[model samples]
Target: MMSLYLLNTKNTYTVAALMEIAKELGKEDWDFSQNPCDGNPNWVTPTGNLSQSKNVVICTCAHNDSCHVVNITLMRQDLTGVLPPSLAKLPSIKVINLAFNYLNGTIPNEWASTKLEFISLSGNRLSGSIPTFLSNITTLGYLSLENNLFSGKVPAELGQLKNLYLL
Candidate 1:
């Protein structure tokens, strides 16, 4: 016999993290209408819909019925303020593009542990040294820290990524 693991419950961490992200970005009305996977076909008790929400997208998990946030693209929204550290809670996130905005402050150190493959923070007003932890994300293939106020030398560890093609 084979063992199986399923996640029937909602991803509360991602929900809370999104709430914090909206609050931090000054878009308090972004969306909290319901759980991301509330009314999906896989759920035992489906209710509500995710399509009503704007500026948000989700990806369903394969081994489980639950959904996880995979991308957050708020490019050129004129958004201001710093990124909340809470965003790291979304373990499944892959792409985070907040480019062409007025956001400032340092990149949250908490993001160093994410499974991010693409990160585009270009055309912003962010200032500070790029966190060394970024080089630790082996999944990272594309990085765009250009057009910012980042100081210090690039981490040598980034060269270790075999999949990375863009910078």
Candidate 2:
């Protein structure tokens, strides 16, 4: 997907989206000067370290060297801020784990169309009824919404997720 990301530098917008997301999440030290898909510690947490799986941006590179983001894990960071709508801009993103943060606010409606399959917003300060639109993300399989301030019955639409095995 290099061609896709390099055509007029399309990745610039992706980086901008990441920056906006990082800013909203109160995340710092991300050096966007280097290619985020390069597996740099500034962008990806090195494997086998104490911080492994705690914070990272995992990407998949095509045979042509075009890289697309697929997973974002930001567990237990003590981060503060609301869930940013810019997250929906990562067209290839699928999994997101922002558990154990100080984030507040309900999920953004903009995410209803994303291809996300696994989402964990548990252990935060988020409130409001869970959006029924979550069922619209047909790819969703695992969801963790526990340990929050949310109220209301779990949407029956979620039962339509035939692939959903965990909640």
What residue runs in model 1 are displaced by over 4 Å at the alpha carbon?
A: 1-8, 34-56, 61-64
State the lDDT of candidate 2 residue by residue for 1-167, as single tens digits: 11222312646677778888888888876676667787778777777888523778888877766667789888888888888788899999999999999999999998898999999999999999999999999999999999999999999999999889998
Badly placed stretches (over 4 Å) of model 2 are: 1-8, 51-53
Report the lDDT tens digits of candidate 1 across residue range 1-167: 21212233466566677777877766543435544444333221223543422244456666655678787766766788787677788888998888888888988988888898999899899888887788878899999999999999887888888878998
Clashes of each: 0, 2
Candidate 1, residue 99: CA error in Å? 0.6
For model 2, name the residue pairs that clash. 1-66, 2-66
Residues forming the 10-long window of minimal summed lDDT in candidate 2: 1-10
Winning candidate number (TM-score): 2
